[model samples]
Each structure stands twice: as C-alpha cells, then as structure tokens.
Target chain A: MSLDQNDIAKLARLARIRIEPESVADLQQRLGDILNMVDTMQAVDTTGVDPMANPYDAFQRLRADEVTETDQREKFQAIAPSTEDGLYLVPKVID
Target chain B: MPSYTVAEILQKLESRECSSEEITQSYLDAIAKQDGTINSYITVTAEQALAQARAADELRAKGDAPALCGLPIAHKDIFCTDGIRTSCASKMLDNFIAPYNATVVEKLAAAGVVTLGKTNLDEFAMGSSNETSFYGPVRNPWDINCVPGGSSGGSAAAVAAGLAPIATGTDTGGSIRQPAALCGLTGLKPSYGRVSRYGMIAFASSLDQGGPIARTAEDAAIMMQAMAGFDLRDSTSMDVPVPDYRAALNNDIKGKKIGVPKEYFSAGLHPDIAAAVQTALAEYQKLGAELVEISLPHTELAVPCYYVIAPAEASTNLSRYDGVRYGYRCEDPQDLDDLYTRTREEGFGEEVKRRIMVGTYALSAGFYDAYYRKAQQIRRLIRNDFVEAFKQVDFIAGPTAPNPAFALGEKANDPVTMYLEDIYTISVNLAGLPAISLPAGFSNGKPVSLQLIGRDFDEAGLLAAAHQYQQISDWHRQIAPHAV
Candidate 1:
C-alpha cells in the first residue's frame, strides 16, 4: 500500500494537479502515511454488504424533462476568467 | 444588545423595541472593532448590510416583519452569495464572485436575515482545523494561540466573538460542531437532505449538509426553521414537510433514552473531555432522562471510511474547477494540460492537494474495488451500527472532539493526527443523521462540547435535548471576555 514518488506523480497527473519536483518526496511520505492508515479497512469483512452512497437511502428524484431554468448565460459568464461571444476561452485544443 | 440570541432579537425587532438598522449597526460595529484578532470573516458587506437593515426597518414600519427580519448573520464562504466573492477560503476561488445565490442564502435572504458577509472556512472545507484555510488559520477567541476547530471555524468564531448573532455553517465531517465545540457555541448539522445544497460549493456531496452555528440550541432551532426545506433545484433535497423547529425546542425529553457509545471514551480521548461529557450526561439524567450504555462497534472505522469516500467525491467535484472557466488560472500555459495542472497546483493549499492526490489514487483503475468500493461497504457497517444502537435508545452521546482547541501548529504537520479530530463526529455524517454539539463545559480553560446524534430527520429531538440542558446550564451564555 506504500506509495513511491513515481506513484505520487502518476496520481497528481491523474488528478490534474501539478506537483513541484522538490515537493514530490514530501507528498509521497504524507500520502503513504494516509494510505497506511486506511489500509486497516482491508481487515473488515464486508461480505454481502451493499455499497451505500447516500445516507438517507432515498432514490434520486427526477424532474420533468422540460427546461426549468431561464437563460442566464450572460450572468454566469460574467465571472469567467476569459470569454468571447458567450464562449469560454481556453488554450487551443486543435493543432 | 450585541449579546441577544436570535429568538430575543426577533421579538425585539417585531415589537419595534430595537430597529433592524440599530441592531445591524451594532453587529457591524462589533465586527469592525474585534475581527482583526479573530480573522473570522473573509468579507464584511457592511454597506449592503446597512442597506438591507434600512429596508427591514421599512418593512417593520409596514407591520410585515419576517421572523429573521434585520438579524445580521455570516454565511460560510462555501455558500455562494450573489454578486459577492465566494472564496470557500481557497485561493482557487479567491477572485470568483458568485453570479447566483445558493439556495440557503436565497432562503435566508427571503426570510429577511441581513448578510453581514462571508466567513472563512478550511479551504474548500477540507481540514478539521481552520489551519487549512488559504487565508491563514482563524485564531480561537478563547485562547488566541489555540486553533479554532474548523472547516467552519470562521462561522463559529464569528458567532462566539459576537461578530454576528448567528451564522450559517455546513458539516461534512464535523465542520460545524467541532468549531462550535472549540469556540464554546452551539452547532447543529441537520439530517442529510434536510437543507438544500444548491450552489453550496460541493466538497463531499453526499456527506455535506448546511446547518446553523449559533449561541444556543434555541437560536440554532430558530435559524434551522428558516434554512431547512425541500428545493426543486437540488435533486437530493428531501420532500419531507419542514417542521416548526422553534416549537420543538420545548418538547420534553423526560424518560427519553440516551445512548452512551462505549468506544467513544477510548484511550485517545482527553480525560478532561470525557469527564465533562460524563457530567453533561448526568445532568440529562437529572432532567428525568435515562442513560443507556450502547456500543457502536464500527465507530473506530468512521475516520478511515470517511477519508476514502469524501476525498473520492471531492476529487470529482473539484475537477470542475479546471482553469479555463471561472477561478484562478495559471498564466502563460504551453497547453491545456499545463493550464489545468499548474493552475490547481498553484491554486490549492497543501491539504487540498493531498486529498486530491489520495482520491485520485484510490479511484484509479486497479484500486477502485479495494479502496473506493471497500470504503463504501464499510460506510454501510458504520451506519448499521447507529441504526442498531438507536433501536434501543433515542439518541447517542459523545464528546464533540477528543480534546479542546489545540495550540496552532500542534498537529499541523501530521495529517493523520489532524484527521483524528473528527473521529467522534464523522460517524454521524456517515449515517446521514442529525447531530448537535452544545457547550457542555470547559477543559484546560478552553471549551469542550457534548455531541448528541439522533435518527434521520430527528433534529427536533437533538435540539430539544440540547435546549433542555442549556436551560439548566449557563455555559452557552459565557462569551469570550476578549471579544467584548
């Protein structure tokens, strides 16, 4: 269950968070300790147990397919970091 | 006047004894004078608050005052306040002003509660101590050198220091109650789905619930009456009819059976905290309530189980914060991947990043079954333990936290030790039950709280018990001297 620096780097990459080279060792140690603590879960037998996601055990209520919200694109985009003609701008994707 | 509870303030406002403008002004002034040392608020909308107060006065003149009319309160930064910066105390959203109000904010505003401003929290409500806040740690009002228990630290500290009469707080894993305990205030986390979560920035969606942190159980009840209800906007919002929480405060708890979890008083818990909690239990016995010893056999696994589930959900929820949209963005990115990674790395604090990493690793292709699925199974066991215990007793009681407020930097470097702060509180969230932390007594001069957990949607019972205890004790009334 121990995580090495390479595994830490893989996780950061998977998580989409950049890690500095110097901090990788520190992250490796902390993440490893946390994993070690959680490793105790393996000892518990969960045979025939259902995976409980919601605490209430209630089913997700569905709504009518009809549009319920008014157009608030302008209002929402007002807080965007960069936008053009109602489009959120990001780095170029297509070569 | 600054020391009045929400119930008292409401009466005064309705009788025209104190104008909303005057009350709001008093709170604004207190926050301005004392908040520098406490650092409880991330933003103070005094101009907006005063304007709202003036309107509330006008409404009062027309004899149409709402229950919360003119009562100024702080919202945890996680809940979006329209046109106001909702930082969640994270640099990632340091500059993000919310375009729409969270359902809780909208509900409170509709009830005529004035927004004092947004309060600080553990960055994205991640840490047990407020130390994880990107804005820096919030100091405990009781002992300035000690840490205020958090993710809802700012909200608790604000109310405890009289910055605001009451504040809205969310509890994923004891965020509200832990801070309330350490700061000597009352914090209640309603049953899951009891409060709408719409626009409240998601940390761990399933476990995160919005509630109130105030000076007393009655005040918490008053605020809860306004905050809880079904909302169409939030899919998980319960459709159950909202009860009159204020009326339920006086409901007699005589002959009620209270369960004392045997595992809660383990070796790790502080001796003083155990004694205070035991004394509080004895006081309940004096109130004609019977104490029943019960065992939640899976209690110790709550922390480990929660870490896996919360972080897994958090990892997915936070993925939406990629740099391109609203939020902190890295400059001069070579590509889209670099933009996201660098932005997050630069944007998130150490604890947040650590959680994201752990979550990502746990949910990876090969480890999903072992980590994520297994944790979910363990979650069921933890919840079942509560269900079984409740069959024999009406409520479960334990110390809100293992110890009183710890000194700043005491467990800052050790993540496991920090996670242990929520050991007793996490199970309630895991079970999606209602729980409250009341000011039982003090340990080492800092406040210790007694936590009570009830069945699903049973906040009424929890509040009533807390209210009865509060009537017989004055601990909830003791304000920090330095705050005054």
Candidate 2:
C-alpha cells in the first residue's frame, strides 16, 4: 500500500505531466494516501460480480457512415503547434 | 422579481407587464451587485445578453417567442459558447475562444434563453470543491469561509444567490447535486445519456451528464425540457424520448414507496444531517407515502470504483490537450515531447495531474487487469446493490454529503478525503440512475440535502417526489444570505 518516489516519476512520465523534482516526495506521500483510501474497497466481497465496463452496455446508435462534417483542416490546423500539408508535424518516428 | 419561476416569467412576458429586455437588465444588475461577493460567474456576457433580450422581445411582439425566451441563464465555462471564452476553468483554455457553440449552448440559444455569462468550476471539472479552479474559488453564500460544493458550485451559487434564474451544470460524480445541496438549490442529474454531451467538455464520458441547477424542481424540469434530447454528434446520446418533465411535477405522492437506505445512515454521517433527513422522510410519510428500509450492501465500493473508472476514462479523454491543437502552448520547446509535457504541466491543476497519473497507472499494460478490470467488477456489484434495492422501494434516500459544507481549505490538501465527500452521491452516477437532491431541511444554520435516486430515465418520478416535497416545505424558497 505504498507508492515509491520512482513510481511517481514513472507515472508522471506516462501522463506527460511536468512534476517539479522536489514535489516527487509530496506526490509519493499523496499517492500513498489515495491508494490507501482506495484500499477500502478490499473489504467488499465482489466474488461472482460481473464487471461494469460501461454504465451504458447498449451498442452505440451511430449514424450511417457519412461525411456529415465539412473538412475544417485548414482552419483547425491554423492553431496547431506545427503543421504542414494538412498534417501535424511530430518528431520523425522512423528516424 | 426575486422568486419568479420560469413559467411565471414567461406569463409576464405575454401580459406585457415585463419585456425581455427589462428582465435581462434586472438580472444583469442583480448579478453585478451579487456576483461581486459570490464570485459565481467567471464571465458575464453583457452585450450578448442585451442583444438577445432585444431579439426575444421582438419575437414576443410577433407572438412567436419560445417558452424560455429572454430568460437569463448561466452556462458552465466548460461548454463551448461561440465567440465567448469557454475556459473550462483551466489555464489551458483561458485564452482559447470557442469558434463554435456546443450543441447544448446552441439549443439553449435557439430556445431564446439569454446568455448571462460563463460560470466558474474546478479545472476541467476534476475536483469536488471549486478551490481547484484556476480562476479562483467560488464562495459559499451561506458561509463565506466554507466551500460551495463543486465542480458546479458557480451554477448553484448563481441560482441560490439570484444572479441567474437557472444555470446549466455538468456532473461527473456529485458535481451538480452536491453543490446544489450545499448551496441550497435543486439540481438534478438525468440518466447517463438523458442530456446530450455533444458540446459538453468530456471528463468521464460515461459518468458525466449536463443538467439544470435551479431554485425549484419545477424550474429544473422546465430547463431539462430544452436540454434533454438525442444528438447524432454524440454517439452516447440516448435514442429514448424525453418526456414532459414539468408535466410530471405533480404535487402528489400518495401511496409512494420511499426507501431509506441503511447503508447511507451508517458511520461518518453527521447528527444534524441525520436529523434533517429523518424530518424530510417524516414529511414524505405524512403525504400518504410508506417508508421502506433498504440496503445497498456494496455501497462502500462506490468511491474506489468511481475513482478508478472516472480517472481511467478521464486519462484518455484529457489526452487531447497535447499543445498540438488549440489551447495553451509553451514559449519554447526542445522537442515535440517537451512541448506536450511542459504545456500540459503548466495548464492543468495539481488535482487534474494526480488523476491523469492515477488513471494512466491503472490503465497501463501490466496493471490494467488488476486495477481497471477489478474496479469495473466492483462497479457492477455496487450497481446490482441498487437494482436489488429498487425492487423493494421506488427511490433510495441519503444525505448528499455526510455533513454540511466544510471550510475552504479543509479537504483541499487531501484529494482522497475530498473525493469521499462525494461518497453518497457518486453511486448514482456510476449506476446511471436519475438522481436529484432536494432541500430536505437544514443542520444548524446550513442547509441539508436528501438525494432521491430512481431507476434509469425515471426523472419524471424523481421530480414528482421532489416537487411534492417542496409543496409542503419552504426549504426551496429560502434565499442565500446576501441575496435575502
């Protein structure tokens, strides 16, 4: 029921959050407190209970596959960090 | 002017006793004088309000005005309002002006409701208290030092303080109802897909629902009429027909079977809250209703289940803000990864970051089955508990929170403690049931709210019970401290 500082750093990396190096200790302590609270669920016996993956189990009522939306790439990409030729420019994955 | 319902206001417009411009101006003046102390509205749309009021008046002249024409309403900052800064109470969207209107906002506008302004809330609707908001905390009108429960605190405060007649609020967990109770208002969260989520900013997709925070259940019903509908844009939007919510608000609950869940009255419940709830239950019994004792054995599992599922969904939903699209951008970045990380780190609040990390960890490769899948199973058990109890009772009753509003800084430091404050109310969201918190009574000087939860899409029955209670009691009529 403990969260190590290293685990906190790893979590931060995965979440893409910039946690200050000094706050790692605080984050560890806080995460420990939270995990301990969640541990309260262990008292409830959930044997043979079906998992509720979604509150809505029904199939999504989708419209027929159609281009209902007009292409707004030029307008939307105007605000992107980096874009060229209607594409977002992330770092070269193959490189 | 102080206690006019939406129906009554519409009547006044027909009689020409009041024009839409006059109604809108009076509300603007009231908001100006009252919102200074309450800090409810983050942005007030004065120009748009005046213009819209003028338009509603013109429509009325032609005798073609909508039922809600000229009615001033507060929109949560989370909804995208065209040409308006829909900040979502986060630094990320502070400078981001919404290019288009959210479907709900557009529908409300189409109904001729005047846009009063954008109300403040927790950053990205992440926390229970409005303290986590980047704009600043919205003060509780009852006790300035105590927190107005959130992330719908602003909307609740506005309605309670008479800043706006009614306001739109989105609840992921107890966001709307808990705050409504704390602020002494009637707020309802319809079934999971009752209200369209097309324009609503995503938190936990399954749990989050936008509904009304109003002075009375009748008002909430009127507002819900315009809000609840199917939208092709939102895939999760229900295909079921939205009933006449106002028509079901009959002040009759004879032979009603009310359930008092034993699990809700267990440890950690404040004595004052218990007394208030008992009194409300007593009132229901007097109205020819029978009180039935029910048990939701898996109640304890709700908090943990909600924490896991909500954050897991939130982690995925919130990933869209990567500094690649519209929102906050860092001044300089060494690489693409650096750009995404620093911008998000700077934009989101502490609580938001904590949830994203927790969600990411729970949903990660190695821990997915252990944490996410396990939590999902517990969620089903918790819901089954409700279904089992509903068979014996028409509705389940409980304190919205264990106690009245807490001091501003009390639960802010510990996120777990703050999350538990919503323990009693979170289960309804998890179960996708329509639940409403009525102004049951008061504890000491502060108000207490008793949450009435019903079967999925049973908002009519819930509102009927709430409206019936309000008819015999003046709790809903009680005004905010300063507003009075």
Interface RMSD per candidate (angstroms): 0.9, 2.1
Tens-place lDDT per residue, model 2, B343-456, is 889989888888898899889889886678888888887788888888888888888888798999998998988998898999998888889998977876788898999888
Model 2 chain A lowest lDDT segment of ten: A86-95
CA shift of A15, model 1, Å:
0.7
DockQ comparisons of all candidates to the true complex: 0.84, 0.60
Model 1, B374-435: lDDT tens per residue? 99999999999998998999999999999899999999999999999999999899999999
How would you class the docking of model 1? high
Candidate with the greatest TM-score versus the true structure = 1
Residues A1-95, model 1: lDDT tens digits: 78787798789889999888999889888998999998889999999999999876778898789987899999888888889999998889899
Residue-level error in angstroms, candidate 2, position B113? 0.6
**What interface RMSD does candidate 1 have?**
0.9
Against the correct fold, how does model 1 do in TM-score?
A: 0.99
Cα lDDT for residue B426, candidate 2 = 91
- How much of the true A–B contact set does each candidate keep? 0.81, 0.64
Model 1 chain A poorest ten-residue lDDT run: A1-10
